[model samples]
Each structure stands twice: as structure tokens, then as C-alpha cells.
Target: MPERGATGPRVLLRRLREVMAQPASAQVRLDRIVKIIAADMVAEVCSIYLKRQPQVLELFATEGLNPDAVHKTTMRVGEGLIGDIAANAAALNLADAQASPKFAYKPETGEDPYQSLMGVPILRDGRVLGVLAVQNQTRRHYTDEEVEALETVAMVVAEMVTGDLIDPASLSGEEGRIGPRLVKGLALCDGVAIGTAVLHEPRVEVHSLIAEDPEAERMRLLRAVDELRASLEELFARAELGAMKGEHREILETYLMFAEDKGWLRRMTEAVEQGLTAEAAAERVHNETRARMLRQTDPYLRERLHDLDDLTNRLLRKLVGEETAAVYALPDDAVVIARAMGPAELLDYPRDKLAGVVLEDGSPTAHVTILARALDIPMVGRVGEMADLLRTGDPVIVDGEAGEIHLRPAPDVLEAFRAKTKLRAQRRAAFARARTLPPVTRDGVRIALNMNAGLPFDLPHLAETNADGIGLFRTELQYMIGSEMPRLNAQSAFYREVLDTAGDKPVVFRTLDLGGDKLLPYGRQLHEDNPALGWRAIRMALDRPALLRYQIRALLEAAGGRALWLMFPMVADVTEFDAARALVDHELGRLDRFGKPRPADLKVGAMLEVPSLAMRIRAMAGRADFISVGSNDLLQFYFAADRGNPRLAGRYERLSPAALGLLRHIVTEAEAAGIPVSLCGEMAGRPLEAMALVALGFRALSMPAAAIGPVKLMVRSLTIATAERFILDRLTSPAATIRRELEEFAFHEGVIV
Candidate 1:
């Protein structure tokens, strides 16, 4: 697109490299770089704004603007054009700056006459380090090519912004010292843990961007690409993946298409040929592609960028000769910090060593957080740019209850955390002594405290929690973790281990509840605008009857004369429950015909997750074995909110009147049928919520391992009749929510929070 011997991103990078290599001050290099960018982009103005912390960006260098504006103009992210680019981590191009709606007049910059503006985020890894901008006096539109080129240059210069070259001089105060930083985030799981930060996907540091020998770098790039292609081919050819052809096949082929893309290969080769190292070349193209993709308004397209980013991570590691195995060798007291992670990635870390997990990007319902809760590992998420703020082995404290982290905290802070932890430990110790004691309330009401488990890792905690039984063993996790369709034998073996671990203790396995967000690795994900309400759980299992039969058969075979308590999830109606139960009956008959061992006792139940199921409980009374209220899904649906969305987290409460009425209906229906009902999910994990559930006549409570002690303590303190009377009295109110009154009651009763 440029004339021969003229400039573009590559040329600008080359010139910037020369300037960086020069023996000059940081100020001079910044001044020269701005001038060079202005000249290269053929713009009248160029400026650099570096982020000093989480909130603000300061003008560091500029050319063709008011000289006084340099180091004087400051704006918080989202304050101006530069701020918008920084806030969104995207490029903002305008043909007319004054005409733009987001335009903010900066008198100090003295650029009121400029009509055109284009700014791109300077990024390192996934974090926005600063912003680079160019403006023109005449009305102008920046082409996609120009935006891409500038973003590429910005990537190359992001390291300089973060490094010592500008550090000591860039900061204006003592707090600017690059030491430890504290940040707050949303709590995903409950507990407290102090540990060292372990980056899940540690950056593959590329020291040399500009190569001494371009041809050699080109050859290196070619070899890496070839190896990468071969690796993908081998993955496709794997014997285990043979049956995965139609299911997970499209994913591999899509990856193959990217691996074999001519344009992608050319970009790498061209970058290498133009004096960049193989890793650097790949990084350049990857950054350029990401910068473009992440800026889009469409979420689906933005999500697709992760595939390319992952591929780049893999390629960079291969180019640098780094082994993936070594990257995951977790240290003691490890608190994993990741930009994001899949369920499998979270499972790979040893639970014994993994004290906590901190996600820069994640939701409450993410399986990683779910599993962390099961393991009693503290977790916090949505801490933006956490990886950039934390270094591996940096001392950090994860306060999941408060949803805060202290990086290299002061001694007094450490002592305070230790004291708090000790008090919790002492309380847990007291509860531990009563582990063998009956879970009976003060007025002699028996409570069935249980644990929610999914994996073999959860088995050990059962004894520790002193649970009466496993209330919800999510069978979907095994299928979710696998790469392909697991055969009947494999399914049976996994279920057998879960049964064996439970021994004499009762275990209620929730049949495969995959779909919605809990998608299988080897299954086609349905396209749905509102996934939570779409085809999932019993809906999916019933559509494919064979799949449901196989799991039922496995459960029967694995029980080996022991009683089997299995439940169906997301039962929209009594008919769905009947249909699901019919599958189990068919499996039982087929197993009987084949002389296969069946459960000595079989109890079928429906998960009361949908409000429709609660309404139809009168019809399901004699038909259903028992009912378990899935409080997580129930609350979200009752309030018409998505549980995965952080914004809606505080919108509803477990003790809301609607929730109380819905739950009361289930309890009343179950009582009329003389069948037991349980309340499980995140709500049961909190002591106050657990107390409210107990008050609502939910005798069985299944929760994360860490919650058992506190909940049991709450149960021991309450008289059920008194709690019921109090709750019923409060429920008479027409108010939408009763959480405030419930909290007051818990306080009056001295329930531990």
C-alpha cells in the first residue's frame, strides 16, 4: 500500500528500534518517537498517554500540539478521545473530531482547530499500557490499513512504556513506585488464602524483536509453522479423536484452516523477512489481529479472537523452545492468576497446592469458580489487568469474602489477615470436634447437611465436612472434561469411583445437566440468544434418548447392589420428569435382561430449578421420587435475571418474598406427598441463606465443602419452630424482598456470617 522505500508499521518499528538503541535520555526518545509517528502517518499531531495506575492516564509526550500540554494534560480513562481508546482497548478514528459526540475540549492541548483524530491502544499481552494518537487539521478518515499499522507500532512500543526507560521519570509522586498494589474484585468463592501469584498462561518473553539475520529468522519461522501444522494434523489423527470427527471435528478443522491460512503464513514470513525474529513476527501479526477483532461491537466475533490468541501462545512457546509441562508445575501456596481459563486448565492445577484462583476476566458461574468452591479453594474474579499487576511468586493475600487482594501487603495488614484466619481456624476446629455429633438443632430438629461434588478430588472433603451424604454429584463434569464421547465402560468406571468413595454414605447423582453454559468439549453447542432458557439439561438429554439411557445404565451398573439416588435437572414439567424416569426404567429392564447388576434400591427425583416444575409439584407428588430445589437457577429465573451477569448479582436475594413463596410451595407439595426436599447451590453455602432455607422447611442442604462447618454451626444454634414462625410472620409482608428482615433476624439470633 506504500511506495517503494517509503514507510508503514514495519518501517516505523525499524526507525523506533534505532532510536531506542541510541544512547539518549527517555525524554528525547519519546519526543523523537512522537515526531517520527506524526511524520510516518502524515499527520500534523501525535501524542502518547501512559496509564500511571488503574484510574488515570497522563500525557507524556507530544509533537505538533501545544508544547505546554506535554506532561501537563491528564485525563481519567473515559474522559476524552485518548481516554475512550484506553478505556475500550481499541482504536478510535474520526473524520471530524469536533463533530464527534465523545469529543472533550482540552484547552491545555490547544488543538481545537484539529478536525480529524485517530487513536490506538498501546497494549502488552492483554493489558492496555497506554494510547498512541495522531490528529490532522483537515477532515480525514483513517483507513483500516492505517489503523492496523499504528496498532502494530503501538504493540512494539508498549514494552518501552512499562520498562525503566520511562519509569522513575514518568511517575509524579511517591505512590507511583513500582512495588506492590492492592485491588478489589468480585468474590467467586468463599475463603481466605495467602499465597504467591502463579500466572496460568505466563507470557513467553521475546527479548529480540529485530533480528540480526532476517533470512535465518525466516527459516526459523517456516520450521515453526511446519511443526505447528504437523502438531494439528497429529491431533486430528489421534486414535482417541477418531469418533470426535463430527462432534469436535469442526473446531480442529477451523484451527487447521487458521494454521494453513496463506495470508497468516505470509504475514509471519514477511515480518521475519523485514528484520523481526520468528516469535516477534508472530506476536506482531497476533497483536494486529487482536487489536482489530477486540474493538468490534459484536461479542461473538470478539470471543473468536481467543482462538487466535491461544494459537499464538502455542506458536510462541514452540518458537522459544519452552515446554508446556514446565509451565504448570505449581509452587506451594499457589494462587493462580489468569486473564481467563477453561475448566480443564483449572483442573490441571493440583488442588492440594492451589490455595486460590484469581481471574482477570470471569463470571460467578464459570466452572473454574464452581470447581474451586467445591475444593474449598478461595477465588476472586474480574480483576482487570491482574496479570500485568502481579508477578509470579509475588506475595499476595486473597480475601474471597471481601473480594479483595493485597499484593505484598504491609506487615500490619499481614498480621490482621493472619489474626482473622486464626479466629476462623479456631472456629472450624471447634466445629471439627462435633463432626461425629448429630446435626440436630437446639429444639431437636434433625438437619441433613450434605456436600455437592463432581470429581474424585471432592471425595476426600466429604469426611472433612462430616456430610450426611453427597446431595448433588454432577455427572456432567466427567463428560465436560473429556475430549471425546466417553464409551459406556468409561462412564461406568467414573461413576463406580464416585460410589466407592461414598461407601456407606448416601450419594445422589444429578444426571448429565450439560448444555446452556456447561457445554461438552465434544458436542455441538446450540446457537441461542438466551442460552439459559434455550435447549439444555433434560431438554437435550430427552432429544437424544440414547445418551440419557447410557448414563442411566452406567449408574445402575456402578451401584453394584447399593442404593442409587439420581435426579434429573431443569425439569420444566412433570411430563419431562416422567419421560426422564422412563429412560431409567428402560435401562433397568435392559440391564435386568442382560443379568447386569442394578441398584439394590433406586430413588428418582427432579431438580426444582424451573418455576414451572414448582407449580406442577402437585401433579409430580406421587410420580416424582423427591424434589431438590436448585436455588441458584431458581433465584435467577424467579427474578428474571441471569446469574452469570455480575450486574444482576445484587438484584435478587434468596430470602425475597417471591423466592420464599416458591420454596414454600415445593415444601408444601413434598410434605403432602411425604417425600423429602433439598436446597442446593451457592445460596446454601452462606450461613445466613442456609438459615433462611432451614426456616423455609428445606431439611436437606447441600453446599461447598468449606460451608459445612459454618452452616452446621448455624443449624445447631436455631430452633426450627422458632425460625419457621419468624419467617412465616415476615413472609406475610407484600414487599418484594425480605432479605433485610432476614439479616436482622440472623443478627438477633447470633448466626455467624
Candidate 2:
């Protein structure tokens, strides 16, 4: 084998450009290109296998082998060396190609004489377009230089395959064009939205692949790196961000570190030296990194891929002189698609025009999910690798309620969703009519329907839904959104604004439920194996008394001369509640010492999230004012399942007899001891779940604002006595869940659930 030099790839790329410039059929150009690759690399065979679909690769063109195999040979992804390259989006080099376990021989290809083979994936925007390979008869290893040269050539090949040179329609199979596809994911926010898909951060197309001046391209790459670094540094230098302390700060620091990474710079600089434009260098390097990271099983390492992708995108845009603007000329009804994004990024869109959001990766507890909930936008998450499957203007239906995404739906499917949307609008109007009605059932049992809130944005919904009060005020959101810890006055002012907006309506303030998934930007970072069960909520508060005291003082000051309702979350036993209550008492004492005004009335409660708390509820009632069943956490803890894990999402049934039994026990115990009990969790937001809870003796339900009206209508139509009797009969049943039964009952009884 001859020594492969640095200029070999450049020379090949120059010839390929000449072929692409000539007016010829795609087939003719591809045929000539393969011949050039075979001669330049001095290989026995050179083949180009284009991805016909997600799972299959077809031989498109070849040289130095049987021409009969050009359009006939095919292999499933991961079936052979070519397939392996496509599946993993990585290169393969072999001294003896036939010895590898992944080798798949095709008689038509007539390549049994080949001994060594080297292949590289033709990648664009982190997606595998095809595989480019060279085979040699002699048993020999491909050098690193040879591998780099092949990868560089493959990059140029990707441009040709995806560009006007090769029509995707011609390469595609009998499907003609991509058709309607339904993808399932997790519901982050519940609603339904019909819109066109729009990528949150669209990839900037690099038109100039080959560099006219390598030195100029190298300088351009360096300049973009410096600008990227300066921008991130300026962000960190802002007053609020400068004082940031914990997880959020750490994330930004990581972003900055990546922007200044020497290894990343070296890779892109080398790509430029290999004769690619600055933008192309960034694109190539990012594509390579993303492909390698996508195959990693380590979640932490895989997650960092998003950071790398974002940084590289910024650099690419800079190189192309594109402005870093958040706004886009989006369609009137646009659904944003992203791998993952922050709350601020979501807020950048024109909310009125933005209909929904779909994330390839996201969780219910993610800040963006919370923002989506507050803004009343439909959002579905964990839709794997959607960016590659979807186009910018494709019609999409975000069925967030069902956690389904319908991409380019057939006419009938689209019409059905349109009808569903119409019906949903009608239901909303009905809910609005029942907004001011009392939540009194036909059996004369009065239930309290309250809204759960956190941000000030949720305040208007209190009036819109006409909720009885704010049942669960998640205080952690204020801390989560800011870069630095909110000072006493700022916290106090925000709380005051909430109270003022509520007017006479009671608000239950749950003290900073910080740790766990709701970690603060300014708090100490904790790495926990099982964060849900680790030091969180009341546990973190008690351990850090000053943090609790600061928040308590703010709440106290904010509620001066008004009634104050506060709760301690994740209380395991009476002792924990007692300790947390003691902090509130201390804050009241401090107010008195400073001659400051105090709340006219104070009610301290325990949030029943831990299972052990149920056993101690009787004692808890004696000391606490009320008990709010944190059903979301309690049910997960009872079932010993992580709520965030998608695999376990359907494994545990929240409507199971055991779950209701436990909740029934808590309500019974709390009632016997003369303490008011309410449920404030995701379960309360669903009409069916709320109906079951009512049957189990829960009278107070706090849910998302959108749910109050529907739950209210259900309550007004239900007869508690009949519901109780029906539910009691099933409490001892062997059924895994009573969901179907409940739905049937609601339908027959006209319960509006």
C-alpha cells in the first residue's frame, strides 16, 4: 500500500467537485465518483451504499466490482459491515473483512476476493445518509491517515447525496415519499394542539464544503471560537448569573468550558486544515461527536451531547454570519420541536402563535415542562430522534393528553383530530360556564376545588377557573428560575403579589420543596442515586434551617395582617412536621422581636408524601392544622417505582385497589382525628382520578387550573354515596386497576369525567 498523505483527501474532493459541476444524471455522476475514489485510494473495490429507509441500506454505485450489484444488493442496518457503519454512524476498519462476525457476503457483489475493508458513514446533521467503503485484496490494516481521508471524503459525499445532485425521491423505496407516522411519547403537559412542525434551533446548512483558502478558514474557525467564548463569558458576568451557585450555574459553566475546550478546537481546526470551510468544519466535527455520543450507554455522557450540539451550532451560525436571534417567522399555529431546551428558550417564541412543543428528550419535572403547564401549552416529550424524521413545515398533531405525535397525518386522521379539536373547544366553553358554580354533588356533599400554582403567570387562572383557593403553591419555582438566591425582599414581594392577586382566596404555601428534581440554581448541589427518595423537600429544609427560616420570614412578612396557610412537604412522621413547624414559629417570633406585622391567622400543615406518614397520620392530626396528600410522590413511593422512568410509567397503576386503599386509610385516619385532608398531585388534575378520590372520601382537591372546571362539573353531577358504594365494592377486588371500570361508570352515569 502507498503512504496516504494529508493532500490525498483534498485532491479527491477537488475532482469530486468537478464531477458535481458537470451536467449529468445522478447515476452517471455517482458512477464516475466511485471510479475516482477507487483509483485515488488504490483499492480493489469502492462502493456507495445509500440508506433507502431507517432500517435498510441499498448498494447505489460501485467500481472495481460486479456492476450487476449496483442497484440490487441490500442489507438491514447492523446486518453487515456496511450496515454496522450505518447503524452506529461510525467508521469501521478491518485487516481481514471476511473474518469479522458482522461480515455478510452477497454473491452478486462478486467481492469475495477482497481481504481488507474500510468504511465510513456519510453523515449530515448527525444523521447517517449512507456508507462509503473501500476494499483491498491484500490483508492489511488501514492507517489513521487513510481513515481520516475516507471520513473527509464521506462528508463531501453526504452533501451530494442529500443535495440536488441526488434526488431523495429517487433513492427512496416504493413508499414514494415519507407518509403518515404516529409516534408515542410521555405527556409533559396535557392538551391537544394542531400545528406545523418548526425546529427550535434549526441546523444551519453549510453550502461551502471545500475551502478555497485553508488558512482563511482556519482563521474563521478561531474567530468564531473566540466570539462564542466571549458571549458565554458575558452571560456569566451578568449580575444575577454572576452570583449563581448550583446546578444551573454548573450547567452554564460546562457550556463555557466546552466553548473553550482545546480538544474541540483542535478537531475543528484539523478539519479546516483538511480543506473544509469554517462552517463545514464545525458541522463535520459536531456530526462526528454526535454520532459517537449517540452510541454511548452512559446517560450522563449522552446528555452532555446536547451541550456539545448547542455549542457547535452557535459556532456554525457565527461562522456563517447568522444572527443569534430567538424569534422565527413561524406559522400561525406552530409546534416547536427540540431535543431539549430550557424554560427561557421556550419563552422566546411568540406564545400566541406557538401552539405546542415536542421534545426528543424531556421529563414532567423539567422546568420547560413547568413553563408549558403555566402557559397552558400542549407538550409531549421523549419522542426519540424526531428531528431527523420531521420536516419544518410538516403538519403535526400534538396529542399531549394521549402523549402521541401524528406527523403528516392522512386526510382521515387529520379530519378526525379536527373534529376532536372542535369538540374540545365546545367542552372548554362548557367548563367556562360551570366556572362559578359551587362544587356541590347531587348527594349534597360540598367539595373544595382549588388551583395548584407556583409562578405569577398561574395567578390569572385562579380567576379564570374560579377555583376556591390556591391549594398547592410550589415555592421552589421562584428559586429555580433565578440565577441567584432570591433575597428576602424579592421573595417577600413575590409572595405578596401572589397573595394580593388571590385577594380573599386562601393560598397554601408549600415551603421551598427544593432538592430532588426541583433543585435550586443557588442551593448546594447534591448527587443522589435515587433523588426522589434522597434528601429533598422537608428533609433538606430541616437540615438547612436557615434556608427554611429565610423563606418562612418572607412568607410571614408577605402575609402580614392576612391569613397564612403554609405546609411542610415530604414529612415522614410527626417529628419531621413538628421540627418544620418549629421553624415557622421561630420566624413569627423574629417578626415580633422586630416589631413587624404578622399574619392575622396562621395554619401550618403537613404534606403527606411518604408512606410512613400514613401510619402516623393520627398523631399528625393532633399537632398539624391539615394534611395534604402529595399523591404523586406517595403513589410512586408505595409502588416503589420512579415516576420519571418511562418504562415504569405504565407498570404502576395509580388507580389500583391498593393505592386507593392506602389513600382511604390516610383520609379516614385524618378525619377521625379532626384534621382537614386534601389531595394535591397530578392525580387530582384528572377528572376520573378526582372522581375516584371523591369516592374515597377526599373533599378538597387541588389541581392544574385547566382541570378545575372539568373536575367541578364531575363533582356537581356525582352522587358521593353511590360513588362510595361502587368504589368500596372494588377495593377488595383482585383487579390490577379499576381505570376501565371507572371510565365505564362515568359514561353510564353521565358523570362528565
- Compare the candidates by lDDT and give the number of the best one: 2
lDDT of 2 by residue, 1-753 (tens): 565544477788788889988899888888999999888888879999987776778899999789988778999989989999999898899999999998999988999899999999998878788899999989999989889988988988898878644445434333332789998999888889999999888767787888888998899889888988887677567675556443345445655666778999999989988888888888889899988987754344554576677788778778887854355577999999998775445655777899999999877656567657766899999987787677889999999888999999999999999999998999899998887789999989999999998876678888888899999999987777565799999999999999999999999999988766676545566678877789888888899899999999999999988999999999998888889888888888999999998899999998999999899877865689998999988999999988767699775688999998999998899889999999999899988999999999999999988788889989999989988999989999898899999999989888988
Index of the highest-TM-score prediction: 2
TM-score for each predicted model, relative to the true structure = 0.68, 0.69
Residue ranges of candidate 1 with Cα displaced over 4 Å? 1-16, 19-123, 127-184, 188-190, 193-207, 214-274, 278-359, 362-378, 386-397, 406-419, 525-527, 644-650, 734-753
lDDT (tens digit, per residue) of candidate 1 on 576-683: 988998888898898889988788889999999998887787788777788889989988888898866768767776777777877887898889877788989988
Report lDDT per candidate.
0.79, 0.85
By summed lDDT, which 10 consecutive residues of candidate 1 come out lowest? 168-177
Report the CA-based lDDT of candidate 1 relative to the real structure.
Answer: 0.79
Displacement of residue 164 (Cα, Å) in model 2 is 16
